[model samples]
Target: MEGKESKTACSEGFSSIRLCVFLLALLALIVLAQLAQAGISRIWAVDDGEKVKRIDNNHPLATSSDNPVRDGSEVSLFGAKNEVSANEDGRFVVLPVENPRYRGNELFRAFENYYSPRVRELRNRYGLDAVVAGETDEWKRILLLRHWIKSSIAIDNENPTKTRGDTFAILDAALREGKFHCTHFSIVQHAVLNSFGYVTRRLGCGPGLKEDGGHHGVNEVWVNKFRKWVLIDAKYDVHFEKNQMPLSALDIRDEIWRDGAQSVVCVVGPDRHPMKPDSETGKSETRPDTYRWCSWETSTNRFTTFPATSTSTLIMLQDEIFKKNTWYRDGKPHWAYGTPYMILTTRRDWIEWTPNVITSKVTIEDTKARVFLSSCTPNFRSFQTKAGDDTWRDCSEEVELPLAKKGRNCFTFRTINLFGVAGPEHRVEIVYSLDKSEPTTPGTLFSESFDDGKLLNRGWYDGDVFNISADEAYLGVGCIEYPWEKGHTKPSGCSGVRHLFEPTEEVYLRCYIKLSPGWGWTNRTYHPHLMHFLTTENGKYHGPAASHLTLYVEPVNGKLRLAATDIQNKNAPHGLTQGPLRGGYNGKLYDSKEVLFDDSKWYCVEAMFKLNSLDVKNKRPNADGQLRGWFDGKLVIERTDIIFRSADFPGMKINQFLLTPYFGSGLLPHSQTLWIDELAVGTKRVGSVSPPDSSAASATSWGLMLERINQHFPFTFNGAADSAIVYANLKELTSP
Candidate 1:
């Protein structure tokens, strides 16, 4: 629901001229540089914590007299490469030199210092309070801060008439005009957060391994509970969609920090120089004569450069925050420098998994365990990590979360049962872990249901997080309810009466299926349909129904293919498939291959449509020339022509589709599976797919220019303004 608003008209095309120009400029600049090398050189630190007194009296590392000196000796810091001086007061002094080589460090520092007083003043005048309220949790607070920063700063549209000045003036103009660059966005965000008493600092920017070669910006904030600074990328937020992620989440972080975390960096065209060389540091890479510290984060940062939404930007932002301190730092951590290469390193720290205080009483009976425990908090972003694997999976929930105990609220463990307790006299074991990763196919941790006696809703015991349901369940990119609730429609465009249910010990192999025989207008009856069942256990795929259970049903085929064989328990990690399925069968109603339906009497159906020939192009008509309709043991209709086919995703090739309608239950008295015979299969694929009829004459296929102009206005007037009407009548360029 939140991601639906992000759909926008796709842009037409790209410009090769612009790309060529950018590449040429970058090549020229890199060629101009005297040093062309790779790998880490030496690291130099300028730790301000160990304050320096003064700079060397005689110019040694210093190239300018304007450089600040303290204690008559120089010092080094973590990020900045410039020489530092210690004053007589036992405090280190580093003069803000002009045109520094690595502009990111100085710009970040200037941004913080220059705007601190202004930020304070604005807060007092507007009573906006902290950008993020203290009462909010760390993740929420960070999210709020991100939203404020991203929404407030506008992209800088450089006007031909305006003269560029200092970062402050430029940022102010951009903010006033509702336009800002990347650095401007970062600077504003940092200053604003600092004013709110947030521990914030800027990361480095420069060329990256990605296609784009422009200035990048990353930052950090101290998470209270973690008591550590987390990395952030303000530019990524501005560039990409803050809602729907277009690129990989971690890729955005690598663009800013460039520690091999991301594979690519999305950036706008044209190369920009790094910080100008300070008169002090004699190290000159790119000459200062042609370079200017243009805050380009506005149009060409990782997030903004990509065609993404605000939520996607938020996902990337979260990833960036976590990427910091992923690795350890060695020696005097050299401050990252250079135009496009800002080296970043960190030490990995241990993460804690605080267990839920509410104890769950799980009855482990016959290898089956049922636990009803409500976790105090449902950390929305904090997910479960499966044992043995370095990935995180999704879980179902009932309420809004990020579950840490809230005030006056008690957690009630909602009971959602799981079946199939295998392994004779087994011992139940469950562990919990949490981390971050891409969200993928998520399932539960059970084997089979006793009532259905068929495996439908199976789960896995991944030692990390389990897919515990508070209420909702997974359905594609969104979630759906178990039973069809009022107004709860099936996935859009899905045909037939879809009865999706979670089978339990009481309702095993039970469904409402019926059929009608003799084609054409049957006067009183209709065609036939069937329901199939498939089974899975522990998040992995097992063979067809492995249990030898008795079934009772009205005969459809010869005698219902009631008994099954070749049932096996598969434990291979890759073969497991989880979902609404029980067993497999040949549910054929079309073609001259299978004669499943016999008498005209009503009968139950259960079978799997082995999706073999899904070729959209090979659509051929049957004998009657009425589009193929395999139902009630007959090919009722077939068509000679098809509307359209998707050229992009051609691999809809299915493996083995199955179905088996059943009767009679293992424990429940009312449970009964009916005869399964005329199982039908056609060209339709499960889940959402393009319409089968996308012909040129179709309304959807027609090009529509739903264009609008100035749809809303503050004022309405005819002709000209009242005051300007008189002047317009006499004015004709004064005819001079």
Candidate 2:
């Protein structure tokens, strides 16, 4: 499974001064070793022995001009603040004489202390296709670098006896031990940006609102383009932003204090906790309320500046670097120039929704609907809208309108960019007039999506197991979260959404899902089933299984694969006692290796289970029962001549649609999460793509922004040889 790698080693303590000296020496040795293998003459990216193909023949990077004279008109286009310029393709170059107020090189060495071999080797293994992971644009490259470094290290809470405050020593010690915490996280980010000639500072977040009582740590970096200091929470791997542009601590405090949640646009990472367990299921899936204790996502009471940022500096520098933007007009540096604060105003655009299904905009005769949100410049980072009286979240791309809310419902959404700039508010009104609706016919059923931030108000219910979540989703707005304990192993970890289906000769169902990366390996049984159905004796809610069918995903030979199963025996239901689950791999498991399932990507999984004749006397009813599966619109698994049920017991109808999308137990080594969307079942086949393609996953302006961002930061190594290496040990994308 593609997940965070757990790696840590106990560290031996050292005095701050001694640790700094030792780490610098070690870095020098590593540099010397590389020079020995290649040479100082070659401006290479890594010590890979092969001569890098330089982008430009004439020394690729721009050399410092001999005269070092400033051009008056050049400042607006070329960045030469503090004697620096965009030398070539967004890379920075410094003039001969360093600015008296800057300590760029000194900070560079500090970054070297933490850029260990493990970092480089990982980049090499992944090869050139890692720029998307690192990025090319200097500012966003920092974001990607921040994400990769943090994602590589899992949280290790074992308190160390002696933790160094010096940025270089702290980062070295953290990397050497492969352990991470709030401080270590900040150090890694600080080191990387610091190495890249960006002035970065470390700080501590207060325990409460008092800066002096800080318990958590964060970092800040000076973005030359935006010409501002941006606040980044390395622990959460997120940064605050407004209007899609990044924001600083003072900016965040002032805007939030002034405008409250409206000033805050969106978080760049998973900065919120999963929803609280709404109801209860008598299973391991019931998470303790303590799960809500996700401190990283919560608002910091106080933002405290770390003393190391000041004391660790190599020279006595002016504090102006933290405040002013450098503007050169008429061949002179203008340090006092101010840029107007950017804010989004009112937006004028309309959205489209499906009329056939339930939508916030229209009263639907059907169970589902899709809506389209307006676009933005740097593009929509997320949305902030109400669900319940108070439920609001930074929603992603597609939002499923709440059908349960009758009449007209209003929702305000805005577009956000990486710079933390949020665009104008686009208020949308969903009109659901229940009076004007079409009647339903036979061979039809309903669908449910928590996109509206409400539970199923229709026939389906949580059955006391799942909680509605806004953080994760495959499509539309929301999906019910299948929460479970940290280390409990029981079949109870399954999703709690339940619906007793009326009997039909054949029922076809399909749902989009984003699987947990740690699912397959964390599950003891190599195979794990998610959606299962059985015949309820009372035809209501109770778990009575005379027959059953299931669809799930699993790992086969290290690659994720889709699979299915069934227990068609009599009332005993193939010796069923263990919560309606029959023999493991009862028949030939249904799966296709040609199209492996990806945990990180969304897939439309569907299954068609047809019932056998009730008159069949034999246990293995051959002719009538059948099963077929489709993945992402492609047919993968099929079984004809199967016994899904028997005659004597006569519970032929498929009753309970157990909304369980989970592994066997809750005792998982790693906590994982997934999302299910567009879940529906009817007598006819429902392929991955509906007629006219009702997919909300179509590309958008935000998608375009991310595309350009990825292009500039392609997930591949672009041989843009930096003078030396910074920690390249990066993110583990998707499954192996």
For lDDT, the strongest prediction is: 2
Model 2 misplaced regions, further than 4 Å:
1-443, 452-456, 490-495, 517-520, 523-527, 536-539, 542-588, 613-620, 649-651, 665-667, 689-736
lDDT of each: 0.27, 0.42
Query: Per-residue lDDT of 1-736 in model 2, one digit per residue for the tens?
Result: 2222211111343545455555545544554444333212222221122222334334422232422222211111012211111111111110011101111111122222223443343345433136444455666667666776666555654564245544444544555665656666776666555444344666443312222122455676656456455777665566666667776654554453344535454354433222222343211111111111011111111111233232221111111221222223224432222322211111100001011111122222332334444342211245555556765567755666543322234455554443343333444433322112112223547666555444455677755445555334444334666544455443333445667667776787877776543333443435344566655434455442233444343334233343334444324544421134445335345556563554445677777877666554555444566777777777777767665544444555765676654444543544455567767777787455331122232221111101010011112222223112221211111001
Q: Which residue runs does candidate 1 get wrong by more than 4 Å? A: 1-119, 125-127, 130-135, 157-171, 225-228, 235-736
lDDT of 1 at 102: 10
For residues 1-736, what per-residue lDDT tens digits would candidate 1 score against the true structure?
A: 5344323211222244444444444432432231112111111122322322224335432333333332212211222222222111111111111110110121111123323345456456434466545645544555566665555555442422142423345445655654655555555556545554454544433332233233444555433333234444444342221122222222243333444323332321111112333343211211111111111121212221122221111111112233332221222221223224332211111011111112232332322234333322211122221223533333233222221111111122221111110101101122111111111112211111111111223221111211221111111111111111123222122121212224221112211122211111111211111232232221123223441111112233332322212122123222211111245421112232343443223332322222122234654211221123223333333333321112221332222223322222221112111222112222231111121131222211111111111111111112212213322211211111
Please give the range of 10 consecutive residues that has the lowest summed lDDT in model 1. 94-103
Q: What TM-score number comes out for model 2?
A: 0.38
Give me the candidate number with maximum TM-score.
2
Clashes of each: 111, 46
What's the C-alpha lDDT at position 656 in model 1? 20
- TM-scores, all candidates, are 0.21, 0.38
Candidate 1 is scored at a TM of: 0.21
